[model samples]
Target: MKMFLSHLDSPLGTMLLVTDDRQVVRALDFADHKAHLHRGLREHYGEVVLAEILPPVGIVGALVRYFAGELEALNELPTQTAGSDLQRRVWGALRRIPAGSTTTYGKLAKELGFDDPRAAIDIGAANGANPVAIIVPCHRVIGSNGDLKGYAWGLHRKRWLLEHEKAMKPAKEEGRTAMLPGF
Candidate 1:
């Protein structure tokens, strides 16, 4: 598979954006998560040949606006991801998680029609397997107890993204809604 790879500047860090011939986003990840990104690409599209080039203008604009605090900026952006039936369903559900809000793994599993308690494990795994980062909104998922969980990118990045989306209060504020950094 052939794709265009471009680097875009964000407040958190440089982000890698991959787009297809139609300019639809194929994948996106932080520059720091290069390995995760590559693994995702290889799984979704075997033998990907990435060419250094600019991403779609509309996609870049949306990300710019998203980082600038416009939470709805990504709502209309188009993306295509390849995964199994359940994985695809889980990824689609992740997108429905509102930007300034969050859902728990167990809760997400239940919402997806899974009554078994262990479904949270599957949900968590699917969330980890998500190829698209912010656009898919996987960062909005938290533990059932409302504690932060592992992010493929890192816990810090997840917390930062939640704070950026106002889903969680900043680490500095002393409030029940806030999570202290390094905790």
Candidate 2:
């Protein structure tokens, strides 16, 4: 198992993007979270090999467009991820959440037809385990109280993504907000 790793500059921050030989994204994590990314890779594909290389041009271009305000650029990009059935389902549901909208874990569980009270917690776990980031749109899911919650990357990145997509208003001088360009 050889995976290509590349650095991508985004409005939020530098990201470590990994892609399989087929150019399908395996994981996309913040450069600052390098340890977490490597740990996830080891967990997902035990004893793997990583090589430094440029990511597929198409994927990079799409992400560049996305950060440039073409929000739908990633809608059709191809992605392949490895996870349990529940995690896969949660990721699929995440992709269905339109760019400018959001959902809570509770509502997502209901959509999956889970009536158990703990479904949200389970779903949150799966969401946290998502390998690919923006492509899976995991940031689109928020707390039931309409407040931002845990984002493996960082709350500031989550807030930036939501704000970039216009799903959330830029935090009102909350200090956690990223000083976005083109403001």
TM-score of each predicted structure versus truth: 0.92, 0.93
- Across residues 46-71, which tens digit of lDDT does each residue of candidate 2 receive? 87799999768999999999998999
Clashes of 1: 0
Q: What is the lDDT of candidate 1?
A: 0.88
Worst 10 residues of 1 by lDDT: 174-183
RMSD of each: 3.2, 2.4
RMSD of 1: 3.2
Error of 1 at 65 (Å): 1.0
Which residue pairs of candidate 2 clash? none
CA lDDT of every candidate? 0.88, 0.89
How high a TM-score does candidate 2 get? Answer: 0.93
Off by over 4 Å in 1: 173-183
Candidate 2 weakest ten by summed lDDT = 174-183
